[model samples]
Target: MKKLLTLSLSFVLASTLFIGTANFAHAAKAPAQPAVSAVAKTVKQSKSYSMILSALAQNDVIGQFDPTEITANEVGALINKVTQENPQVLYYKSANVWSNGKIEFAYSLPADVMKKNRVALDAKVKKVVASINKPGLSELDKVKAVHDYLVLNTEYDYANLQKNTIPADSYTAHGALLGGVAVCDGYTKAAQLLLNKLGIENHYVIGQIGDGLHSWNQVKLNDNYYFMDVTWNDPVPNRPGIIAYDYFLVTSNQLRKDHSWIEKNWAVATDKRYSYLQTGKTAAK
Candidate 1:
């Protein structure tokens, strides 16, 4: 993975290969398994989640990859994996229509709109990165920079959730980068994308947070790994101009107080060097 980290956590309820009319919410309401667990077998076709994401990244609905031994449940897990990995690719609606193990991945946006939005999305990410990014900033500073930009620029789309009109784009990095409105998935993916631009290593950590499945990031700092949930740090109900560090840069032990995930799959995050609270970077709550 070239030391490039890509991870995002979302509620496990969204594991199915959701197909629906036009709204992200509609597709999300379908049946799903817990995050990181086996993907529900929605399609009998063979495909790798990683390969499907690569094709989608190029805006090609049709894509090919070696038919791996990975099972359908694994492919299903890619629903969240692909979403987190390619935070910027928003046109992915579903994966159906396979011939000879070649997938015709269905996209939410039309060909023209996909191209147009992709261009716009690319431009927006560059502009945003250029504006907040500065020379000679440390890794911690870079993390904070990205965190601040997202919290300041974007607002949680409570209205969309209430109206049930949430666009599919809102479920992606573009949602936070362009629309300035997203739920936890958009927020977490946007953070990872910006971190990748700064050459940071991280992973999407999926698990149960309280009563629902929520997504967050496992970020690296000073050659040590730590957990950060930007979505949790950013308060909702349109606080307008406040960013909380309560959930910023925490240890696995600290994180386990509320959030939960499979521990065996990831490195044991025992380092507290960058923990905002433990390091006295921020006042303890």
Candidate 2:
């Protein structure tokens, strides 16, 4: 799911890609904006990042900025940065940037659904973390705890994907954690949130699998980086008590055979000490 095009009149630019969800839906050009007394600052400026994050958490549109701070082509990069860096920010699906200095992000779920479900989602996250994290657990063990939990507990949303009626929650942590059904983005976001809460260093990754866009994660364990794809590890039929570790903790050479991503965008994953295939083990206790 990717789109990059420029409009003649409004100079509208929308970049929408949430992997298997929405399938690169287009964002219409917004109406003209009212004048502001002062130009808005870039998100990199002190305090501006937090303000924008807060607005995004509430599914609000952020306008009144200097369009020069972010051009149309750069909007997609910004959206990815925000979601990847801040795992808790799970609802944004795409971004719309106009030459008139207005920008808005489209969310996977509606504003009302987000408001109604966010609290419950937060609670579920805390509960799951509490249940799995224990004293004296190693970092590797913590990572495995998250990976195993997602693979064993959540069912892939194959029905919706086939029917093209995927609910917005299916693209979010809420669906993976609460609804127990999710696609690639949902599984990745849920893993990102869980790993962050467990004090693990990880980042969500975007890339291509065959012709379709996909989402996964990269983790730093024992000072070595590795990629983990919880979605793929969970089989499509979703057999009970079965978890596949084929995609767990693999290095760049191993993953590149099947996965393709922009090298410059992510950290190079070359270490294999923690790879499940090589060690036949994921963690110690």
Candidate 3:
């Protein structure tokens, strides 16, 4: 019997595949295997993660490799790591892992559509980064600029989320950057793309918010890690010209009040110096 494991991480476009292993939340709710633990776990298996990433980067739709007898959970972790690392590879969504080490990916959009969206997304990302990541801007400043830009521009896809009619692009950075609407996944991916362009160190986080699935980002500033959730900062109902910094550059303890994640595949964020609320920077602004 071939075991088929379907990994769904709170994405808007998630669908139920044949029952096999774990069932993760969609992007609306977003991630919680604690950020620090997620990073630690993935590090131990970095070799396998790198190999899978290399193949995906080559745009190979389906590939086979010896992952050295990984279980369903490990397969899920590996796929999540790759997705987190390469947010630009937004076309690929879910991974279909077989017992024999054969891996197939299900794309969120068709090839032709993805190609067009990729071009548009890349152009938009370049423009946005150039505008926000100005010369001599400190890392914190750059992160804030991108965070505010995203919140001010993109509106959460409440309509689709409520109607269960979410568009494929709404789950990717392309939607957040170009379409002006997205879910948490889209927001996180867009942040990842912008930060990568700015040369800021960051990682994508997959976890949960009180039993609900969600996705976010953790960024490195002056060697200290901090969590950022761009989606939560961007209010629903399409509020324009308002940016919420509640979750901006926050520590794990601060975020843990409402957000919970697995403690296996990410970095523990404890720095509070850059937290917008910690220094009362929001009050001054």
Global lDDT of model 2: 0.65
Model 2 lDDT per residue over 228-251, tens place:
988877655667677667678999
Worst 10 residues of 3 by lDDT: 16-25
Q: At residue 118, what lDDT does model 3 achieve?
A: 74
Runs off by more than 4 Å, candidate 1: 1-51, 68-80, 97-99, 276-285
Better TM-score candidate (1, 3): 3
Once model 3 is optimally superposed onto the true structure by TM-score, how far is the C-alpha of residue 38 displaced, in angstroms? 4.6
Better of 1 and 2 by lDDT: 2
Clashes of each: 7, 0, 37
Per-residue CA lDDT of model 3 for 1-285, tens digit only, reads 977765553233542111101121234423222123335544566666766676565445675545564665566656655666787876565667777777777676677777787788889988998898777889889998889888888888777776778787787888888999888888998999899999998888877765566778989999998899887776556667766677889989988876777644567888778654544223222
Per-candidate TM-score against the hidden true structure: 0.76, 0.76, 0.79
Candidate 1 scores a C-alpha RMSD against the true structure in Å of: 8.8
Each candidate's lDDT (Cα)? 0.63, 0.65, 0.70
Error of 2 at 5 (Å): 12
Identify the superior model by lDDT, candidate 1 or candidate 3.
3
